[model samples]
Target: MTKKGDQRQAEELDPRKQTILKAVVDDYVETAEPVGSESLLQRYPLGVKPATVRNEMATISDMGYLHQPHTSAGRAPTHRGYRYYVDRLAEPMNEDEARQIARRLAKTVESQPEMVTATLRMLSGITRYAAVATTARDQSLKLLKCVVTPLTRGRALMMCAFDNGSVDSHVVDLGSALSAQQMRRLNASIAKLVEGQQAAEVVALKLSLPVVEDRFLQDAIARTLRAAQSSARVATRGELYYEGILKMMEHVEFQRSLESLEQVLGALQDKHRVYDAMEQTPENELSVMVGEENPVPELQNCSMVVARYKAGKREGGVIGVVGPARMRYSETLPLVQQMARSLSGVLAKLIEE
Candidate 1:
C-alpha cells in the first residue's frame, strides 16, 4: 500500500483495537512506562475481558504501532504509533484561552528581533519544550532613518530604522566626545550615505568619507556602518531565537540519556540545520513531525510541531516546539497552532503602526 493508504489503514482500525491502542499511548505518554493490558483496563473503560485486551494489544504490536521493549513486558507506542495518533487529533484552542493568550502577547516589542525573542520565550514557558523562531525581515527593505544619540563616557548610540518596521542599533566607543555642531554634521552625512538604500546595498557600499574631516566623527560613522551591515546579513538570513533548552531537559526521555539530549541540542545549535527543518512547513500551515520523520539525523529521535507566520505579503517566519515523541499532542498541538496565529496577528499590527 502507498503511504497514504497505510495511514488510512491505521486510521481504519477496528473500534476495539483503536480503543486499546489509544489507551496504551495515553498511559505511556503520562507515565513514561510500558502499559500492560491490566494497567490499561484499570484506568480506561475498555469494556473487554483481560484476555481480549491482551490479544488486541498483541495484534496492535504486530501491526507495528506498539512494541514490547522486553519479551514479557508491556507495550509502548512506537514512532509510527505516535504519527497515527497525532494525525487523528482535532483539538482546537478554546476561544477564551486564545483571547487571553493573544492579549498577553499584544504588547508591542521594540523591533523585529525583540518580537521574535519575546514570542519564543513565551512559547517555551507555556509548553515546557524548547522553542525556536525565525525573524523574517526582507533584505531589500530600505533604510528609513538613522539616529545618533550621544552618551557619556566617550560613547554614542547609533540606531538604523528600516522601512519594514525593523530596527538595528549599536553602541560605539567614540574615544572622544563630539560637540553638538559636530554631531549634527555627522548625522547629516551619515544619513545621506545610507538613507533610502536597501540593506544589502548599504552593506556592500564603498564608503566615500563625508566632507567634514573630524577624525573622531569619521571613526564613529565607520563603526556604525559596519554594525548595520552585520545586522543586515543576520536579518536577511532569518536570524534564529531559541529558549527553554533547560526546561526540556526535565523530561524523562532526556534525563534517561544525556548523550541523546546532547545530540539533539547540538543539532538545534546549528542555525542552518534549524532553518532547514523549520522550512519544511509551508507558509500558513501546521506540521507535526514525529520521531524518524525529521530529516536531521540527530533529531530523528525527537518530535517537532511547527507553524509558519507571515509578517508581510511575501515575507514569512516559522515557530516551533521540540520534544520527545511522547509529547502531549492534545495540549501542545493546539498551543503551537494558536501561538503562531497570535504571533502573526501581533506582527501584522506592529507593521501597520
Candidate 2:
C-alpha cells in the first residue's frame, strides 16, 4: 500500500488496537512463531479477556497489519506490522548494551582494514546475522613523497607515495632531456602542491609551466602530478567486508530464499553493489527494511538493519546486519547503532595514530 494509505490506517487505530499490534509484533519477533490471542493474553498483562484479544487480532489481520498462515494457526506480523513496530512501538536499546558494544570495539587491530574486518566480525557475533562493512567513499589521500627517475631520453618514471602505504607510478615523456637537479626540484614542487590536500582537491589543480625555468622540467612535473592524482581517485573504490553468512544461513527464512542466496552473495562480494545497498537508505539513521521493502530483489525475503559510521574526518560510511525478516528487532536494532558508532570511533583513532 501507499504511504498515505499506511498513515491513514495507523491514525484510524485506537489505543487498544495499537497496543495489541505492538504486542503481536514483539512476540513474533522473539519466538519466530505465530501469535494467537491465547498466547498474547497469557504473555502480556493486558486486562482484556481472550475474546476481546481474539477480536482485536482478527481486526488487525483484516487491516493488513497481520497475517494468518493457516485456518487454525495463530497470526504473525506482516511487513506493514513490522514497519509500524519499528516506527512507533520499538523501544530504544539501553545504556548498558551500548557500553558493552563500545568496549568490544576498542580493542586494537593491526591496520584500518583489520579494524573494518573486526567490526563486522564482532557485529555478526552479537546479532547472529550476516554483518557487512563498507568503507567511506572518500578518504583524505595524504601525499607522503614523490620520486622522479630518468628512464631514457625524453622519458621519466614518477612514483608517488600516499599515507595509506600504497605507491603508484607512471612514466612521463618529458619531450626533452632532464638533469638530476631538475628532477629533484620537480619532485619537491609537486609534493609542496599536494602533500596535505585531499585527492579530489589536488586532482583539479592547475600547475604552472613557469614555476621552473626549463620547459622540459616543468612539462615532466605536470605530467607526473596529473598521473598521481588520477591514480588516487581510481583507488577510491570503497572496500566491501562481510562476515557471518553461515550464521545467517542457520535461519529458516534465508533457507527458503535458496535460489536468491547466490545472487545475494554475489552482490555482497561486489563492493559497488554493496555500496548501492548502503545508499538505499539515508545516512546516520538506523532502518529496518523488511521483505518487499528491500530495494534489491535478492533481499526481498530478507530484512536489513543498517546504520552509518564515520570513516574518519569529513566523510562517513555504512555498516549493518542482514537477516531473515523474522529477526528480533528489539534485540538487533540498538546493537547495530552502537556498533556503528564504535566503528566510527575506531576508524578515527586509527587515523589519529
Candidate 3:
C-alpha cells in the first residue's frame, strides 16, 4: 500500500484501541517486557474492566499491531504497532531541554572535527544509543590558503585550509632545508599555482614552476606538491563519525542473541550502506524508521531517527540515532530534532566566520 493508504488505515483504528496500543508501547519501552491488560489497568487510566481490555488487546493482536511472543506471555507491539504509535505521538519538547541542548551545542569548539566530535558525544550521552553523522564532501570547495611549516631536519608539515571551514594536512620528507628567501618565493609560487583551485580539480592538478637554478628549492617544491595532492584527495571524500557502539550493545535486544548483535555490528561497519540508509530521508527534515521499515537487512530489526542538517547555504549532511525497534519515539524525536537544529546553526556560523 501507499504511505497515504497505510496512514489512513492506521487512523481508522478506534480511539480505545489507539489508547491501549500507546499504553502497551510505552510500557514495553520502559520495561522491555510484554504488557498484559492487568498491568495496563494498574499503570494507565484505561476506563474499562479486565474482560473488556483483554478482549480489545486480543482484537488488536489479530489485526497484526501487537504480537504474543509465547502462548502464555502477554502481548507486545509488532513493527506495525510501533509505526502506529510513532505516527500518533504528539508530545512536544520541553523548553528547559531545548535550552540545555542549545547551550551545550554552543560550547563546542569552533572547528569542523571538534564540532562533529562534541555533537556525537552529546547525542549519544542524551539518547544512550549509537550516534552517527556524515559530512558531505563538497567538490567545489576552494583552497583558500596553504601553509607549509618546516619541521625537523628533513621533514615539513603542509596544512591546506578549504572554503568549507575544513583543514587537511600532510607531512612530507623534504630532501633539504629551504632558505628564507627561497621559502617566500616557494610560497608565492604555490599560491599562484593552486590556491583558487577547487578540491576536485586539485586532486589531479600538477604544481610546476619556472626553471629555478637551486636544486634544494626544486626538491622542496616537488615534495610539497605531492603532499598537496594527498591533502586534496582527503578533502574530496566524505567524512563519517560514529560513537557509542559499545554502549548500544548494553541494551537487552542485542544481548538476546549473539548472531543478531554481530549482524547489526557488521552492517554498521559498512560506511556506504549506512550512508545509503541516511540518504532515504529528505534534506532539512526528521525521519523515523522502525523495525521492518528500515531498508538495510541488518537494520530491519532496529529503529532509526535521522535528520539532515545544513552545513552552509548549499551544503548539507545527515545525523542519526540507532537503537532497537522498541525505542522511545516520543523522547527520541525531539532530541534528534534539537540536535539537528543546533548542528545546523553552529555549522552555518562556522562557515560564515
**Candidate topping lDDT:** 3
Clashes of each: 0, 0, 0
lDDT pick, better of 1 and 3: 3
Which portions of model 2 show Cα errors greater than 4 Å?
Answer: 1-12, 138-236, 260-267
Q: lDDT by residue for model 2 over 269-334, one digit each (tens)?
A: 666555667755566678667766776666766778888888677456678888877777778888
Better of 1 and 2 by lDDT: 1
Better of 1 and 3 by TM-score: 3
Relative to the unseen true structure, what is the C-alpha lDDT of residue 19 in candidate 3, on a scale of 0 to 100?
Answer: 89
The candidate scoring highest on TM-score is: 3
C-alpha TM-scores of all predictions: 0.69, 0.68, 0.70
Q: Each model's C-alpha lDDT? A: 0.79, 0.75, 0.81
| Number of clashing residue pairs, candidate 3 | 0
- Extract clashing residue pairs from model 2: none
Give the lDDT of residue 67 in candidate 3.
94
Cα TM-score of candidate 3: 0.70
Taking the tens digit of each residue's C-alpha lDDT, what string does model 3 give over 1-353? 01111232553479998889899999999988999899999999999998999999999998889999998988999988888877775366899999899888988757876787789888898888889887876688888898888788767788899887889888878787777787787777667667989977776666445467888887777778778877776676677789897766878888888888899889889876777677567766788888877878888888888888887786567887888888988888888889988888888888998
Off by over 4 Å in 3: 1-11, 139-237
